[model samples]
Target: MATGTGIGTEIQISDSSDEQVILKTKMIKLDTHNWVQWSCQMENYLTARRYDDLFMPPSEETKRSSKFRQKNSSALALLWGCVSSELEGVLLDNKTSFYDTWEVLGNICGKNSIVTICETFYELISLKYKPESSLQAHIHSFQKLCARYNSITSDKVLKATFPPKLLAATFIRSLNGDKELTGLVQTLYDIKPFTPAAVISRVAIEHSRRQPNEQALFAGSSNKSMQKTKWDEQKQRNKGQRSGKKYDKPGPSDKNDSDKRMDNIKKMLEKLQASMKPQSAHLTTESNIKTVVPTLMLS
Candidate 1:
């Protein structure tokens, strides 16, 4: 039997031709969330099968053989199966060459934006282990995010000036409080050329060796509940302030002062209107007298 790794699993093929080989491989479907890793795996699989040539347009001079056509059709079907339902709709009417299909999918799924890549990198770097989750699960999540970041950034020129130890230390610092694991990670970081894989392996071993503590788990849960309670209280306080019910509620003195200001504004407007009315009356009377005096002089 020969063993080989494909995608996310190990496959063992029987040496005997008569024996049926059971292929074990995980189907990594392409979706918006996992396009990067899916594209990487598909590229690897295609390159391994020498089907990468299908990515180029067929030359006019080249005559297609029946065997080549069959293989190409089969490859297309396999590629279609790997795509998600939404992508399948996009590719439904596509009956063209594999290269055309590949290009279409690339255009649709390949974000390749520098801003998107930076956001993904930031998310990976800022990943924190949830208190409710296991150490192994958290590590797996970190690895997946790291893989995604790497796939998105594979084309970009990254700065490798930082030492491996520094990288490992940074990752350890991001992890939640696990004193024993943190100490182990520090010790591993002290050794030069500490790779992420090495740190992961050591952490896994240490995690497995340590027994589960009911008390610690309970304490973590309690802390989470306490945090949630505090958040709820803060949220309620914010709501009260927004509604002007609690923090910003008007006091008796403030209400009286506001009423006094309004009254003063009203009195000022009344006085101004009274003064304008008298001036209007005086102007009208003076105009009437001038007209009467002109009539008397004419007579």
Candidate 2:
């Protein structure tokens, strides 16, 4: 008897053993084109829970009965939890019994209306490959759409059919938006026995082949980006060192400046020594003349 309050609806019912049976709505949620499978699963599940009686219309006497009302309430809870949000809204708006709600669902999805057929046709033609999902899933979805469209159109006044060639073509067209799968389209068309099965098989093969290549490409690009980032960081560090406030160690520019200063000092020392040599020579000449004059006087 446990239940959830809001959109994440859960209804628990007791089985013969009095164990709680949790309803998983996702497993039986009615999709746009899955009424056949959905109805089957729903019926099977409800039958297991002994609530399949709700599938039939309630008589006037049973409608007023307390036991029938209780069963109907549980059936309604299960039905509401099993349907998608869109269909849940339709059920809510009707505000009817379980049998009436079941009837409404059958009318909308069980029997193919003109509007439903046209919508399915439009969706099949306009479907594109979404990168979020795999190529295989895209192809499978296309196949399902084709099946639904054909099934619905089979009983129409002007019966429509999707041939194998058209299905293959439509699938290929759907894959056009995906860069990786687009290459296989022409190859699929060129192969003999152009059919959906052939195209799907080829696509699956190509997808498996390209998976490793894609991962390798991603790894290579990531490595290159990492290297570039490290290089940039090193460059920035060198720039900061060159412009650092503290000059504790001499850099290339500092070493160059020190060499220039040493060269200038050497040149200045050489010039001073050259000037002192000439003055010494002149003094030595003057002393020799004095000595010569004195020696001549003594003789």
Counted clashes in each candidate structure: 0, 0
Q: Scored by CA lDDT, what does every candidate get?
A: 0.62, 0.70
- Candidate 2 structure quality by residue, lDDT tens digits, 1-299: 43455544455665444555555543446756667667666677678777777788778998898867877777776666667767877778666598887777878775557776787889999999886477767777887888778767877583877778987888888877766655666687896698888878888897788689889999999999999998896666557657853333445556675466556655654565567867564533535544544343334
Residues 30-111 of candidate 1 have per-residue lDDT tens digits of 7766667776776776666555667677665332755456545655676656776688876666655666777777768755
**How high is the lDDT of residue 119 in model 1?**
74
Q: What are the C-alpha RMSDs, in order, of all predicted structures?
A: 21.4, 15.3
**Model 1 lDDT, full chain set:** 0.62
RMSD in angstroms between candidate 2 and the native structure over all alpha carbons: 15.3
Which residue pairs collide, candidate 1? none
lDDT of 1 at 9: 34
RMSD of 1: 21.4
List the pairs of residues colliding in candidate 2: none
